[model samples]
Target: MATYTINVNGKKREVDADPDTPLLWVLRDHLGLVGTKYGCGVASCGACTIHLDGSAVRSCSVPVGAIENQKITSIEGLSEKGDHPVQLAWKEHDVPQCGYCQAGQIMSASALLKKNANPTDDEIMGAMAGNICRCGTYNRINAAIKTAVKNS
Candidate 1:
């Protein structure tokens, strides 16, 4: 085991873990930030999506040792009061059915918006392509993205 300090949610967090430990486990198991969930355990599912240096990434496949000193933002850090524009838009659109993939969805959407304050529909679709919603709420997700853009 080795000690590594990483910046998460704008705070420096220290954890002792193996080099190859997935960042998902480091956040959920070591740091007790369970907001980032484990879905497929592979990078295919976006349930473990989080922001690494302002870009959305699948945490399940990212080793903790690889991200030292980088800024990591999980769902919990998206907003202080759970009222981020995307989150509010999500609620407004009622996007989640199962809600298992919503966090990742939100993270991906937020990252897209951050990079492009006004993304076209095609752009939005491209950005969210990697995230899969089992409940198949793509329409609502798209609506929420548009709403978030308007609110932003």
Candidate 2:
């Protein structure tokens, strides 16, 4: 087993496991941070989205050892009281259908908002293009993002 030190959700963590282990498993299994879900292990679904060094990344495709010393932030770290503007907007706009994909969707939206506080509809769609919501909440998601931008 290889040892890797990673910063997750603003805390330092030391884990011993195979280097090839996906960061998703490491976070869910070792660290007990289960906010990042496992949808498509192949990185196609964006369900395991997380911020790796401030960029949204598919945790399922990231090797644990590859992110040594890199800052990682999961949905849990998005807000202490689950009140980040995006989260609030999500609630305000009622963006979830089944809610399985909301976490990843929120992560992706948060990343986009970080870069562009006031994104156009096309920009919002572009930023969230990779994340697939099986519940077909795309319209609501876009509205929520716009609401977040306006509220922010």
Candidate 3:
């Protein structure tokens, strides 16, 4: 085991874990940040999405030791009061069904908007295609992303 210092939600956090531990476990277990969910253990699903150094990343596929000095932003840290534009849009559009995938959905949408504030329909779909919602809320998710774009 080894210790790695990482910046999470604008705060410095240190964790001692195996070098190969996925950032998902580190965030949820080590740092007590469980907003980042565990969907597929592999990187196929985007349920473990997070922002690593301002870029959307699959935390489940990112090794803890490889993320030292990077800034990590989980769903809990997406906004001060869960009021980020994407979050507001999600709520306004009623995007969650089981709510298990909403956190990753929001994180991905937020990242998409960060890069393309005025993304077209194709862009929105392409950006969010990787994050699957088993409840089949694709239309609502798309609408919410567009709403977030408008609201922002």
Candidate 4:
């Protein structure tokens, strides 16, 4: 095992893990940050999405050792009080159904908004295409993103 220091949620965190271990496991198993869920062990699913250096990434596919010095932001760190505009919009629009994919969806939306404050419908769909909601809440998700844009 190798030791690595990573910046997660603006905090410096140290963990000892194998070089091939995915960042998802490090955050959930090692750091006890379970907001980033594990849907597919591969990178196909966005369930393990997190922000790495201001870009949304799939933590399930990102190796811990390769993420040193990068800033990681999970759903828990998005807002201390859970009042981020996107989160608020999420609540206002009632976007969640099963709630399994909401965290990743929120993370992806927040990242997209960070880059583009006023994204068009196409842009919103394109940015959130990677995340899948089994409950098929696409319409609500799209509405929530629009609300977040207006609210923010």
Deviating ranges (above 4 Å) for candidate 1: none
Cand. 1 TM to true fold: 0.98
Compose the digit string of candidate 4's lDDT tens values, residues 57-152: 999999987886889999999999999999999999999999998999999999999999999999999999999999999999999999999999
**Residue 5 in model 2: lDDT:** 82
Clashing pairs in 1: none
- TM-score of every candidate relative to the true structure: 0.98, 0.97, 0.98, 0.98
lDDT per residue, candidate 2, 29-130, as tens digits?
Answer: 999999899998999888999998878899999999788678999999999999999999999988888888889999999999998988888898888999
Which residue pairs overlap in candidate 4's backbone?
A: none
Model 3: per-residue Cα lDDT at residue 50: 98
The local distance difference test score of each candidate is: 0.96, 0.91, 0.91, 0.94
Point out where model 3 deviates above 4 Å. none
Residue 105 of model 1 has an lDDT of 95
TM-score of 2: 0.97
lDDT of 3 at 114: 93
Error of 2 at 123 (Å): 1.3
Worst 10 residues of 2 by lDDT: 93-102
Per-residue lDDT value at 99 in model 4: 94
Give the lowest summed-lDDT range of ten residues in model 3: 64-73
Candidate 3 lDDT by residue in tens digits, 1-152:
99888899999888999999999999999999999999998987899999998788999999998986888899999999988999998989998999998888889999989989999989988888899999999999998888888899
Candidate 3 positional error at 40, Å? 0.6
> After best superposition, candidate 4 residue 69: deviation in angstroms?
0.8
